[model samples]
Target: MARDRARLGGRRAAGLFAAGTAVALALATGGSLSQAGAATQSDAAAQTAVQAPKATHSQIQLLAINDFHGNLEPATGSGGKINDIPAGGAAYLATHLKELRAAAKAKGQDSVTVAAGDLIGASPLLSAAFHDEPTVEALSGMGLEAASVGNHEFDEGWHELLRMQTGGCLPDGDGQNNQNSCPDPKHPFEGAKYKYLSANVFFTNTQKTLFAPYTIKTFKDGKKVAFIGMTLENTPNIVTKSGVEGLTFKNEVATANALVPELKKKGVKSIVVLLHEGGFPADPKAYNSCPGISGPIVDINAGLDPEIDAIISGHTHQAYNCSLPDKAGKPRLVTSASSFGRLVTEVRLSIDNATGDVDRTNTLAQNQIVTQDVVQDPKTAKLIAKYKALVAPIEGKVIGHISTPSVVRTNDDSLESPLGNLIADAQLADPSVVSAGKAPVAAFMNPGGIRADLASNAGAVTFGQAFTVQPFNNFLVSMDMTGAQIKALLEQQFSGVNGPEAAKYKVLQVAGITYTWNPAAAAGSKVVAGSIKIGGQPLVDGTSYRIVTNNFLSDGGDGFPAFTTATNKVFGGLDIDAFANYLSAHDPYTPVATDRITLGS
Candidate 1:
């Protein structure tokens, strides 16, 4: 670290040069990646670094973060802390990356910065208001080379995702979701300086992909390392339909395995997969421990070719380090950095000069907390100040207060969560829908839709804070469903039913209803008989009741197909609007009881 500081100024100058080149081109073409320019500034920076003297140690350092969710400023409340330590924010993240890069450089070790995905979408008001342009620019300014395209990347639809990758200003000027895009007409919204690789996401009926499937980086010594990036295969099911209309996602392992021979043909053996899917750590509090860790990544890793050297994952947003066995039964590194920029996974690779392959025995990984202990990166801080100033008036508005310190989605349990209950209740009480035709007697909110928690701001929350919790901008939807159909929706939350519960059991957060379910029972029969009640009255199979939910659910997102069978559909205002109104109206809202969801028979 000490040795690299002397030359930090030089690298900064080189980075500035690259940024200038990109900005000039963006301005020339109104923020589009011109046909003549095949690479981004990040790629230029990487290529420039390889011109340095060859490293004595054959080690390559990989610094990774995932699920950043556009947090340009330090988070507050429960989401801001990791194990009781103040963490996250783009400035601190940049500081950490520079420090790690500098330290590695001092050791003559080549290093690259990367992310798993969810770098944008479901962001705070500051970033989302600008269509996440600030996030793309911030990561680019700090030097992110590549990342997998997570489900959130498709939240706005195919064209938007492409625009995010290529670069362009949103045509509509301001007041988008109560925020402006391209705030300064003088400076257009340039896209990512980093590459977004999607090996599994492909164009329907075509061999091409939305973006390049993989990328290989060559170092000073002529040693090459290949990175294949991909999101989970079930991305279409989780994201809105329009976003993935003309695309198809292939199996992760198969897609990666098929690419191995091509990479080998190019003499690249040091392979790494940037996967946007992860597992839950048995000990969630301990960032480094991975004992009994289990999830979709485990199976995905096992199916990968043994030639693949390492795996960096995200999506579940929990951190852990483990040496999971590959196809050959030899242990290899698999890691994840918890979400919201709280942790960063550092993976060190020692390659064999003889075969240009990574030696599994020498591979080591660790998750570093992005503590507020370091000096915040000046460039990132300055950039954040720009957005913060513009977002001040709206973001600072006081919404309401809650008695509890937090109403968070941190605990994704089967029964219920305080945050989920609050959202469902808010949707059920939305005046926009209530005053239209018939009022919904019950409201359901998908746990996955709640991004952040309602942090208590000294018992007075701000709109900025509330915006982070539900940023999707999905409108409220009310429809009529038979009691029997409602029962089917409840059953779908478990496996062997019409859902993805085999991997993740999604218990719907409810309002104005109560029911019990047995986890041990067969999936189709998980819902306890005679337990469901609406308005303190026993549910009858033939009875009809109105239910309110988000538009995504009404479209049958997240495996609840029964939502699609409903009738008498009525749309209301945005979910965020309803939440803000509910908070303001309730003033000192107390968290609802968890009694609505019973654990067992």
Candidate 2:
């Protein structure tokens, strides 16, 4: 029934535009009266007087934000700055949106706000403890129209997302039910007013889309626009496989292009794609404006059909505002607003009345930073305040104590850090983990997942603090790999050598085994052959060895391709649980660098 209504509406809109095209052309031509010498005064007068009957042009403005990750408050101090400009917080974002909307209104334009996904999940204690209900309410208040389903959205699986989408108010941990649990009590999920587009995600059993493939929105001026949303096709690899067990993500480019003909049949010529994947700036340190750089975005953009007028992307978390040529050499406007509500990408488009197409002649695209100079929206501010108060009792409730400071860093500076060693030790102790098979051997953790540093000051570490360090809830998996695979994995870590972002590719802290290597060795052959071992026993080249690590590396994240071909793979163990259990079993334990690895002497 909705399809029938939309199709009818699209046809009517197309007919209206066709009738008005002549008048629009006349009005456009009349503005150049000063150039009458080039065309005869009579011709100019005729063009000005005979305006097409339905001649009217529509200007549409699209505003996008991505990776909110449920941060309701401003991220101040360190770790949140862009070009020295402080950014983020819903209140600040609201202020920016209001100004952008007013500017569009002043220019007689229609506007819609959308997101590229990851609006929730891995949230702060304020929202996560409350089941992310407050975050949903905040988004509703922000008036988010449409969003692509980011990987984090599935953290709690599809059932939870559906509840967040259609239900009203989430329950607080307190036995008492509170109406204020969600800010907008009247319409808690109202902000999800716009449909969630999932062009590529489909259910395996039914072979059908769980959500709408795309959405066709009609403007007051009889202009119809279509938006298609998709995340990176590799979502299954990043997310818990069980969470999406019954679904499959198709090829992004193939899914988007397949929908184009259907949209065109519905008389929608102005098309926009909201892909949840973004490109990394070629230079790792280059925070802004890296042009013609190559990464995931390069392949995805080049593969996109010319019919796609604009592409709003996120995931890589880098920001870029530039035009990359499509297969046909026609410039495709691609923009990524930095993550955590730091920026908003705005695309201004003009529609052609003749063929219902965007006026590719003049399209403007740019990313505007959401600076702290703007005031926070009072309503959003209050919502954050309410949640903070609700979680206050448990926010600082220390669950355990540490004897010494555990330094946490992501680069080579993290070698044998106390905190990393502690985490690696915990993974090895968990009997449920494959790495723990028969007394276990060693455990490895990616540095990217550890988000905080354990302060050496004599303070208790709370559940909240531990969660912040390991937010993804990744499960600990154990597998058996030949000694050759271990060496290959280490070498893969340095594959980015001589590349712009080489520093990022370096491995950090390791547990259970220590090895020394020469950075001067060949990229693929860097790991010293004899230096590898487990528990002081030399790794047998032909023998299979049990290894413990998270699912991220097991599936080849962070360029660890060697693990993908492991012969014996096991699963269903939560790494966070292992860490928590280990902490519980060994309170007051202090980590020390116990010869896990040694630098080449």
Candidate 3:
């Protein structure tokens, strides 16, 4: 619960001194004391002994980070800064965590480092290039004990995620199964030393959780704190459908509630939830302030059992230290560290040894920036350097040129972004002519697949920059769909069953197509009737047209079912390769206008 990081120094010292004085006076008067006086003194001494303060509490430190997304090197542009202070590199993050752990030890506090989730997926090229093996090694080197699994962890599917946990490289299959082995072919991919927790995800056939639901951490004083970890329950809706095919994600609140009694039975009363879901605060400038925090986490926190002392969260990637009340109306600490290792949320919990419960009045949390002022950890730096050397050849090769230092990922009000338009156009231009028989009429790109914005130096865009923008390695796909399905696909962007992230209002970025929509209309019917067209031709509902998209969308990633319904599927080149080819063909490319999809309120 929300409380100051109070010290018991003065008051505890004073009580001990008074007790000592009382004992000395009784000893001095014992010889001259009568028998009845002596008996009375003995009774009083016994009472004093019973009333003396014992070490009935212990303070624990929880160091946490989330949504790292594997930037082994310091992030670039705005991603690397907090208030203009450069922040976040695997090396810097390691140093900060080590310093925090050391400081806690100096204060006689035991510390454990953990992460909320999204630790690996959606990573930049350095880590993503080697299946994020380097990131795992770096975090493991920094002493991360445990972390919750985030939705992005499923980006490469469950088995690959398992490989990240359990050591070893993906077996050599068709190049699709294994991108690369370890960062260095000389050494094997040693998996994460820390454990990953997932309470809610269950296999449909077995109905068993994918990972341990919770783990009990024992401190030096025998005080135990139970940590329950879970990703957002809507994970299935946002991740690719195939990655989580046999898996069913359960309700977050229910998952934790069910585990409370079990933990209590095991004599553990102090509880913390490492949740992979987070909230957005109204104050955009304050990293530690939680003014008007709202999201799925709000409801989840409110529903949690009072036994849970705090929740370290992620996924929304906003930083905040909040005091939220549980179902019992007791203030509980809620926190999140912004993504890409930029910050770490430090939480202190004072637990009562006598009751094995957390002392709610002494719970404290704050987000500490991983500033670049400190010396980087040598071990982490070496790990980064090793990977850098391995990737340098391809990493620095120039793929194309941008007319301006550019980015295409931001959306003001309409969903289409300059980057999205560019990517979609690239896919449309480089269709599967050999397999699909001819070029597709149009292409759609999912916003989630666009990981980073390309910013060129001296107008040159390297493979590393393009790879960072579209690193998923998804294959472009071509298919045939009726005009009715095309219109349905456009309507799917409005929200409802097809929209997993309804709050974000996901809109498809398109090329070779145009549509107008009324925001005031109902969700499923928002796209204006008969307004959808390709190449300025009126659409007949029964007529078929060639459509192109990435494998992820064609398989219904991000809830686009219309894409999955397309007929005569033909897969093409890697999405990144297609984008690179398009850029190469049109060197010195200028940012395209994002005016394809119009919206009217």
Candidate 4:
């Protein structure tokens, strides 16, 4: 993953992951990688690799992906499928991209591969173990020209995000961190090859943008295309607070509109926005339909200047292609490829040579699956192989087994999922949380915190699979909250107090408690009165009880502000460690519905 074997986001600067392991073979095979500093080539060099159009007015192809999440290997289970077809793998993705570009080239079309955001973070062991360098290298190899910054990009904090943008070694390199910067003394981690554009993100102290606000790509026909990329304005509410400490995210519409005049001055008429926020659509398949589509994007798109040609979006991980109206009431092209590298949105635009503007009437967009049927890109496969071999010992160790069919994230009618219950119980039973006479009787886990279903190889769960389930390295925290505060916490799950996630449910997976909620009730009064119970007893408003949950939740992540008022907070170790150790202790664990909550009509 390093141009010389870089680590993923530089989890730590310590420990050598077998020096030169990624570089020797990768360089020999001509894998895509660039040292963060001087070794990184110029933009002109990268653009020169593409075939330019010989004819005037040739259509430009925009191949885009979003929320890749560093699934370098072919994802498995439902996560790997789109419309029931197996899809997603960096190798397969590279192959499909090459084929698509080739087809475009044959038609005299110039193509550029780009992404909306979330190319990394919440990754599998293959990319994460090396600090996501593999992912940056893979995407750069596949010709990713530009991308927006997603909330996950700041998971390790803005400083680390800066490290990813520019090349550097992690401060903790070589000896300490769980993930080494892959400790390559020679080739040092190379930053991303593509430009990370953030029109909305700014450092509070400097008031300057974190990265370039926009980048222009010129074509052979003397036409220039301007790309303005940005994450959603509400990034702070979803991600851990400390990660975005000195940064401020401006409104999506305002930021893009403000740049319109600046871009027009540069004679850049064709503008495309790569946004990290998206919406849910009526069609589940989301290949071509956009029936009844609604979300923040609809309104944001409607407010965007008509000068912006198209919108490529990610996050929410839903696939859809829609032509919604822009500010001038003209239909505009907007698309999203589902997460985990499963789909690529191919947008073809007819450029007007005279005006240097996009021909809206001729705009075409489609979501192509990164199907496994195609031959995998060999270079990328070797890159995957290089990292896989390095982390084999740790990733392959069987931590436990699934006694039941599978512990899944799928929620029942009550919104309680098997895997969620398991995670909550794991947190509650964690030795650190429960040790030394700690009396935490309840533990809660946010559904968003559980990234994936617990996967097992032939029923044997490994450390790699465990990492996938809880990829975020958040710590466990036990805090004291009186029953009144706990009840207030439950009430905050609905609208009127939980901020703008009004239509969605933010239910917490629980252990050591049971409660009921009435959906038909008013927003702030949804939780049924007197239904809350802790340790099989009725709620006691005056009594204080210790509850355990991830630090994200305790810090009021996902809008549960009641946690912020909690007292006597105690920090446990990494959440992933607790999950893996729990699996070991509860080996051959059968998953059963805990039936912790009930829903009232």
Task: Report RMSD (Å) for each prediction in the order shown.
Answer: 12.1, 10.3, 12.4, 11.8
Return the clash pairs for model 3, or none.
408-419
Tens digits of lDDT, candidate 1, 1-601: 0000000001110111121223233334544322212332334554344423234337788899999988888777667888887889899889989988998899878898888988887788888877788999999999999999998888777788788888877655476557566887888877888999999999999999999999999986898999999999988778776568889999999999999999999989889999999998777775654556778888998999999988899999887765666677666677888888887787777677677788665555567888887888999999999988888888888989888887776543355888898899899999777645679999999888887778867888988778878888777888899999999989887854344435568888899999988877887898999999999998999999989998778877888888889988877788888999999999899986677888776
Listed in order, each prediction's TM-score against the native is 0.84, 0.78, 0.87, 0.87
Candidate 2 at 258: error in angstroms? 1.4
- Whole-model lDDT values for every prediction: 0.79, 0.67, 0.77, 0.78
Residue 385, model 4: Cα distance from true site in angstroms: 0.7
Superposed Cα deviation of residue 554, candidate 2 (Å): 6.0
- Candidate 4, superposed: residue stretches over 4 Å from native: 1-56, 171-178, 183-186, 434-437, 496-503
Better of 2 and 4 by TM-score: 4
Backbone-clash count (model 3): 1
Tens-digit lDDT track of model 3 for 1-601: 1111100000000011111222223334443212322332344445345332237767688899999988788888888887777889999888988888898898888999888998987788778777888889999999999999999888777877888899897554412322456545678988999899999988896768888988899888688888898999988777766677788899999999999999999988889999999888777546654656778888899999888988899999888764565677666777888989988887767677778677654555557888887888999999988878877776788988999778669864667889998998899988443362567888899888887787787899988888888877777788899999988888788776545445666788899998888877988888888778897887779999888888778877677888878888886777788888899998989988877888774
Model 1 spans > 4 angstroms off: 1-57, 401-414, 434-436, 496-504, 588-595
Q: What is the lDDT of candidate 1?
A: 0.79
The regions of model 2 sitting more than 4 angstroms off are 1-56, 76-78, 168-191, 282-289, 400-406, 413-418, 429-438, 455-460, 477-509, 517-525, 541-547, 551-595, 598-601
Clashes of each: 0, 8, 1, 18
How much is the lDDT of residue 286 in candidate 1? Answer: 52
The residue-by-residue lDDT of candidate 2 on 1-601, one tens digit each, is: 0000000000000001111123223324553212322232224344333322223456678888888877777654444665567778888888788888888888777898888878887666566665577777777778788888887777666656666667655454342211124443453444355567788999986768867878888876678888898988878755655556678889989999999999999988888898888887654333323433557777888998889987888887787755555677665667777777877777766677666787643455456777777667899888888777766655565656677554454234325566777788888888886433354577888776675665433656665566666666676677888888788877776775322354355474567788876666777766777888878888777877787888766766556768787856676456666766676677776666546665562
Ranking by lDDT: 1, 4, 3, 2
- Tell me the tens digit of each residue's lDDT in model 4 across 471-565: 88677888899999999898887764353455568888999999998878888788898889998999999899999998777778788889999
